[model samples]
Target: MTRFRAAPVLRALVTLAVLGSVAACGTGTDAVVQGGTFDFVTPGGKTEIFYDPPSERGTIGNISGPDLMVDGKTTSLSDFAGQPVVVNLWGQWCGPCRGEADDLETVYENTKDLGVAFLGINVKDPQQDKAQDFVTDNNVSYPSVYDPAMRTLTALGGKFPTSVIPSTLVLDREHRVAAVFLKALLAEDLQPVVERVAREQ
Candidate 1:
């Protein structure tokens, strides 16, 4: 598989953000990126819940990479097969990511008993130590795939926005996308949606 570098995409998005042309979180304006089978609903940093039935929902399939916290080891979405997963995309340098890290851990601990798993995809930060330190500092217990190149975003088949840091995706038991959050979020905002998705199937 060809690894896709994230610098170009992130740089472009950063420029847009600086220009005020890109809407940050809480803006609430809906922007849909239609590509292939998945309809990526990026609502100005808000969440987009897929109400379609499980079979009709889109899946990103299996994505794997080196384990950020464990050297010589790898992690993959398929590791949590048959279970619901909360996939978070974050970079250590991102302020929003740092702010939301604790909240993500909170939700993970709260729902792990229900067979809900949380996975973080460490992106953009090429330095492994920085990303690992962020996880350590935040007391994040969940496993993260170290993908500095953001190659896993390519696994989404061009449907997901690689530029969106602090993004979250809640997957159902079938590994289909159930909800998508394009910005930083707290446990209060994430917990309920997770519980609801966990209840399905």
Candidate 2:
């Protein structure tokens, strides 16, 4: 299996420049090389690229069953509806998720006031309590929804299936998927998406 990795800064810079030119030309719904290939509406009102990640795309809907506990209370994805929500599926055992934990916490702090809610769905972790402890130890303020059986994970079509950590889905106010990130996210990388959703209302 070939693992997909994010490009380095220099390569991404070149790709972004090319993508910008393509966007400026007013091409509709065309693929452009930008950092990574992505399907997006360019500033010129054209679809710049079509993002097709075998690991990221999946169906969207309400995830329910056994309640997920945050500080020992039942929780569901619906609780965060009527607002844009960022759902991060992760586990303590995943190294990449740990690498991105601090960044995610920062994202929660920065976007919480914008009416964007952040939640975690703990998946397939043998040490559930330890996973919870990781949250506490990291001082992650966002509430997490636990999925011991990986019902939610399977529902997401096993995107980022290996670690099953660091996979994040961003839902708009209507609970539609706006974006999905398969790797750890930096604050800058996530800012525009949150800002766009925040402006929806």
Candidate 3:
């Protein structure tokens, strides 16, 4: 996703407004809202993990869209049911996305045998070929949902960050969140997190 280019004052005011609203409602401390979509904001360099049991965790609904690399083909979150999934929201134009691509693939390779799955969500790239090229150049084996308008993010429920590029979510076997990383990451940073979720019974 594109960086927030608003002036510092404007950005601060907007953030304050959102925080005030969330606080007023006694909602989650991590909750953030923009363009009518709810998401968990990862203040820079921070990660969020959910330790709630499966019975208490919020589940992500199925999100479907065209395949980024294959025309006329589609992919969905439901396809990976009963497995731990690493869901990444990225854009071909984002530098962090490019930087993390190889690491993501590495983690995917290492953990797939453990019943771990990986899915990418390509967002805001109007030129689909650029997104396709990104996957090809990075040798990404997993499928990504091409969502130029980021519409698929709604399925992640109110706790998912729709506008954060390079953000990641680790879901448990039942598709409920186990961890969230809103910053760019390397294999060393992502592998253990996926493994932890994969170990969940």
List CA RMSD, all candidates.
Answer: 13.6, 19.4, 13.5
Tell me each candidate's TM-score: 0.77, 0.64, 0.75
| Evaluation by lDDT, superior candidate among 1 and 2 | 1
The Cα local distance difference test for each model comes to 0.80, 0.63, 0.78
Give the higher-TM-score candidate: 2 or 3: 3
The numbered model that scores best in lDDT is 1
Two-way lDDT contest, 2 vs 3, winner: 3
Clashing pairs in 1: none
As a TM-score, model 1 comes out at 0.77
Clashing pairs in 2: 39-49, 39-51
Candidate 3 backbone overlaps, count: 0
Candidate 3 structure quality by residue, lDDT tens digits, 5-35: 5577688999999999977765321112123
Q: What is the lDDT of candidate 1?
A: 0.80
Pull out the clashing pairs in model 3.
none
Question: How well does candidate 2 score on lDDT at residue 34?
Answer: 15
Residue 35, model 2: lDDT of: 23
Residue-wise C-alpha lDDT for candidate 2, range 46-152, written one tens digit per residue: 22112233244333556543333444355656777688888788888878888888888888788888898887887776566787788888888877766655655
Clashes of each: 0, 2, 0
Error of 3 at 99 (Å): 0.6
Give the best candidate by TM-score. Answer: 1
